[model samples]
Target: MLSAGFIVAVVFSWIYDITPGGIIRTEPLPKQKLPLINKKVKTYRFTTFVSVIIIIGLLSFNIIDSASARKIEKIDKTIAVLPFTDILPIKYESIVFDYIGNQITAGLSKIDDFNVLPWRSTKNFRKGNKDYVKMGDEMDATILVDWKAIEIEGEKRLTIEMIVAEDEKILWSNDYSIKNSWTEISVISTEISRNIARRLRTFLSLEERARINEIPGSPTALYNAYRGRSIAQNALYLYEMGNRKTDLSDFDVAIDLYTQAIQVDSSFAEAYANRAVTRLWGIYTTHYSGNELEKCLEDIEKAKSIDSNLIEADIAMGFYYYYGKRGFDNALKYFQQALEKDPANVDCLFYLSLVHRRKGNWDEVAELSSQALENDPASALFYINIGTSYDYLHDFEKAIECHNLAIAILPEWPA
Candidate 1:
């Protein structure tokens, strides 16, 4: 209506005169002045058209954005937990500082209704002055969970907040004084997970509640497992960064930590499973010479005997077939099982992509790689996998595009 009225006013001003005398049709200007008047009118019209176009473009963008936001709201159950910020003195910033957030994230991932983004996808936001809502949108997460640890008057304190991604509103928040023992921290993580779930109005099943409440066999074992897992996670990141030849040291350290955990608690299935994974990758990176495949299989069997539904065990078994035996068929089966339990698991998606690549199923390879990339967008390895699939499929244009993206993300990587 505003646009139409503006146009009508412009036309009326050109065609009529509103003077103190009366409303009247304007007579044509003198020939001497007519050119100048016409030029002014033409400029005004061009400006008006441009203004209208700008208005339309702005309106169109808003409409599209609103629609996208609505679509995002429909998936509000999708959540991303960012890494915890440590503001304590440098002396206290150890593996314990990282474990709180990581434990809560693991607990929440057990819930069926909450589609939690993998930690790999959200960890990079730890040090940035990031807008939580924008990060959520980038990761296709409709909610964000963040926490920070700070020391106040010699007392360690932590504050946790859940934010709605659409408006960056704090939907829920709580604070706690940090605990001294690893067991207490584990309990605190479970409490935080439960509190967040309640804030979201979701019902946690009996099994999920058990998972959140289950502390490992002992504080010593749990601490060792936590440290091992942390080291392994970093080692995996370094491996992904194309440091294939020199990254074995971290893996070895991680393996030793896992072994310590296993010694502390013989029934620690997770530690055994993680040790198997580190050993498998260590050998795979060294062209299957660092550790015996049978030792890796023994860990897998030990973990599975203790807990048949262990996802890590399944993953280790999948790699056992892929990297150890080159048994693509068995690799596919184990990976599929793991993916069924955790659809957004980046490792399962990545391994499945590799298996399909070996089977010459380019379409499946691309599909799995794309899913993995969604969970770990900054991962150059996933981009390379997608590029390889495109290359094999004869899509040279897209193949080059994917490789360029990988190179752009990792410019220091060797050609």
Candidate 2:
């Protein structure tokens, strides 16, 4: 006969059901993925790069910069370009500033030398004023770019500054006037990105220079894409700032932002996918009505039909299957497809782990969660999944230890 403790362990294990991926992102896995159930996940995980210096960070998208980011690995190489602020006389011209700010970020992302933090990730740092040097250290950024625009009586003034990451020294500064059309904005932004890259690398390759100069042949399409990206970027900013609230306010605002993007460019497939995912999150987490869920599904289908190769489209379909429709089999397929394209996507990995758990594959759960943890070690949910798997295996000691680690990260109960 089985011992009383063994029976109790099995009973308690079945009673455990904790969900991950709230504010700080997480993925799931089965028990076998974890080498030892009690082993703590490693932090300071780096993005895939050939350089010896690892980027010691996530973006400042989180409401608060984490105190646990002990050291910034490559301060000299990592750069952060904040959204441009407006000191315009006209209030509504602020949208123009948003457009220019996004152009700068998108421009920098194309360069290979620096790890540019996405525009959405810099949203939280837009608070009126702060110490740029301290911000650089907190963000693990070695180069800091700040831009501001002022428009008055028929003249537009633009100022750009680059700060040294170690000490907040302005290495380069320029002030120029925007005397050209809106189309000139992209050209100006690209030149700025190239200037920064050139400063860091000392010389730009032929390809790098070409990429910086490349603009769409049709000026109309170029303008529309930039405008749509700006609006979508704003929605993403709201989403990041929302930081996983239980209410639908954050998701709803993001939906509105994407709606504006679609209005500007009806064929923006990525914007549709973003809306669908945000709506889907609302459907699962908030008290969103069926209409929103239906809209979410519609957006997903529309995005998939529009751009079959979009990774976000695949991720939305996966979320729909797993969380919205409870179709684990289809969810697994879609998520795997998404991960195959964007191998380092932390969200897709965590959601896939959850799907494996539903399929009753504890070993798969361990494997998925473990890999996700390598890229996202601070995720409490990943640790929780590993802990639960050990609990089921009657490794009570390891289980308790894992649970304690999760508690340390987040003191609240995991739902």
Residue-wise C-alpha lDDT for candidate 1, range 98-124, written one tens digit per residue: 666666677788778888776645664
What TM value does model 2 have?
0.54
Q: What is the overall TM-score of model 1 with all chains considered together?
A: 0.71
How accurate locally, in lDDT, is each candidate? Answer: 0.77, 0.65
| Highest lDDT against the true fold, candidate | 1
Give the per-residue lDDT of model 2 (tens digit) for 1-415: 2234444654555565545743332345577785653323332222222121222122222212232222222345666777665455544555566666667777786676666765544643554666887778766677888887766676776788988867777867877678855445777877787777655544567897787787532333445444544443334333333446434465556567677667756777777877777767666664365467688778888988887888888988898887688889999999999999878677778778788878888788767766765553334555576577667656677667667766655565351
Q: Specify the highest-TM-score model's number.
A: 1
Evaluate residue 343 in candidate 2 and report its C-alpha lDDT on the 0 to 100 scale: 83
